[model samples]
Target: MAPQDEPATTDEGFVPLFDGSTLAGWHAAPRTFGSVWPGGPDLAGRADLAQADADARAYPARWEVVDGAIEGFQDPDHPGFGGYLVSDRTFGDFELRLEMRPDWPADTGVMLRRRRDTWHGLQVLVDHRKSGSIGGFFGNGLANFHAVPYVLDVSTGADGTPDGLVLEDPATTLEPMTPDKPARLVRRGDPEAFLAAWRFGDWNRLRVRCVGAKPRATTWVNDVLVAEIDLATLEAPNYDADAVAAFLGRSGHLALEVHDNDPRFGEARWARGARCRWRALEIKELSPGD
Candidate 1:
């Protein structure tokens, strides 16, 4: 692995996505779009295209380069508005590596093979909030299938400030399995190993590898294998591999999300003034031979 401040060498076959000083190759996704639920409204249809484009141009989230890192937060002026910073290039099979440190209460993620026109894809969960789970798989538009290893809660210090995180049993934390909410295909990784590898309040390295049209995606947190999902064959309720492949295709842009602070939650989904910082973003496009 290369240092966080420098790009990987050619020998490593990884090219830098972030230039370390600017958002040169990135653009914002649409703002005001609702979370990509199973039966969510079609915000990208021709009927709404004009409005969606305008929202994208306005880009409600604040994304900027700070101290050699990409900092993303909900724009103060546009409270409750959040969006994604998407890469200009699209990739089919690739391994993405980046370092991220998100503040508590933020529901962020790395959207893989995300549609250029909307927030539809496979999401690697970075939900840094109450009862949230990291390194899980969330189907943004593929029937909302969630495959999480485990959920977690934050530990507070004496001053009532978040001090650390405590892993919780998925059996207790997750909602009961149902037709709309399925977890039977979840690949629950080692919780103790993940906890040991996780660095609280510090930047943690995340690596994701996606391959094939009906992709097999895997995630690692701080070098600890967190979760894996073979989308093509996983027997999860409401998931259709052929339909998903048709919807997303073999290639799409990668995106970094800054989630909305929904009013329904009452409490802010993202902490006020808090930003998630990302650095050392690089990707290695995979070939069939390799």
Candidate 2:
């Protein structure tokens, strides 16, 4: 049964994903963004994820409603781990719009097409720090940006241990599709426009469009096109072309995320004590023509 404030599974046209009073249709994400990858814990080694899942369920304490907005406040004492408020239902082709404000050094973003088991999906970056670029596409569990524009070829020594490698090496074993012009992970049409459009220290509007079987996602920040991503071309280690294609076709949950605290990436210096807020969150489903 649906809660009183929960949105219905089927709505007429556009619908508010959040009810503003409670997290009726949302749950805490099973894991924190960017914590279990790269230099973090091994996902398979974590035997206590269930407890973390339970902690995620008790999200009211971590994420609360304040003045009609959902504010994510991080505990200064518990700095390293982060959490996500994820939608229970999954979505496919649609347009999602929301307004966000990052205080000081808060690192955050919106997640779409996120898989439950793999925890991999397309993340629309909302980083507001001077070194960060908002509206880039983050391929969860991938190399943090667009996949390599070309494939690599390895050369095997006499011992056959594969000693050398090169981009598009003629002796490559796997089939490589090196496009004449490979797609970029994030495409900001006009950097100047993006810079001018940003409303620093205030609410900034963001819109993301995901459509088609190949899922080309384009993001707009304050009415400026910040990025255009071909979801299929997004890459991470061990994710081959087939894996990427399958992920592109499947529907997955939508989420909002906070980057885990890490001193190496300057999170400890900047992200600690930071908070991010979201409001006016909504989504509109799309049809073939529309």
Candidate 3:
């Protein structure tokens, strides 16, 4: 059976995705808003992030309550491209439906199976300009250009795992789709098809569903289906592939992100059990299948 909080697939049916005006089931991570709050393990002073001096604000990554919603914006200068506003808890095997409208020229997506600011599942591309952008993050494993979009190339070493049983070369592991590739089934290997489909300058509606670790993601631009992907077993060398697989077999979080160097706007709303909006939020709980 699916977990109680799994998205869309409810045992009893009709679980609130968000409250009208608050982040109820979610918790803010340490460096949520700006950097961290002034007296916590999270960023309090200034998050030493790349382009920290850009649109980046004070610590805790200042999230504001605007027009009755919890909103986050991209810093025009930061280049991390994976800045996260993660949920403290981990989740799996559920459906998530949310409304998102990007107000900038940045790439966007959310994560599942994230731990301590690390992501282990997939990143459904909001912008269509990445290789395998429709594929999973494949952390320490594989990546589509959109997975880590600062550059079209990936860089890694064999030292990815503590035991070194696996070889991780971000350059090779993370494949990038370039502008030369076209969008045909045969062209899927060329990489450009991944980016050619990317659309910019618009509001996107996203729906993500995870059945254990196998995930299905789809994106819509102004209500038009722009992207879709279905993933089988998500492989990684950083964790015991089997154990990592099991951990994601139950529950996790609906962690949101604002990748570093991004210029987009993001907010999440649900009518679940809570009645609050998320600013710099964090949520923690044992991932499902624990």
Candidate 3, residues 1-290: lDDT per residue as tens digits?
A: 12355544244333554444655555444223321111212322355643444333333232344654566543323323234555544555555555554432334456665554434445544432222233223221123213222223222258742221121234652334443222211112222433343333322334444453544444432333434443443222222435444534445456655444323222211111112122222222223342
Return the TM-score for each candidate structure. 0.85, 0.72, 0.48
Where does model 3 exceed 4 Å of error?
1-12, 30-60, 74-83, 88-90, 128-202, 213-243, 247-249, 262-290
Which whole-number lDDT from 0 to 100 does residue 90 have in model 2?
85
Query: Which stretches in model 1 have alpha-carbon errors above 4 Å?
Result: 1-10, 31-59, 169-186
Off by over 4 Å in 2: 1-12, 30-61, 142-183, 233-239, 266-270
Look at candidate 3 and tell me the lDDT of residue 112.
64
Worst 10 residues of 2 by lDDT: 173-182
lDDT (Cα, tens digit) per residue for candidate 1, span 31-111: 444334445445555564555445545757889999999999987776566788998889999999999999987889999
lDDT of 2 by residue, 1-290 (tens): 25555444435456788777877778775443333333444544466555454443343225777887888765456554566778888888898888898775666778887766445677877655433447766667643444222333334579875343233443532333433213565564565566567666688999999876557788888888767777566454543545555644556778887666453565632366778999988898887446
In model 2, what lDDT does residue 142 have? Answer: 42
Best by TM-score: 1
TM-score, candidate 3, is 0.48
lDDT of each: 0.78, 0.64, 0.37
Please tell me which predicted candidate would have the highest lDDT against the true structure. 1
- Residue 124 local lDDT, model 2: 79
- Tell me the lDDT of model 2 at 74: 58
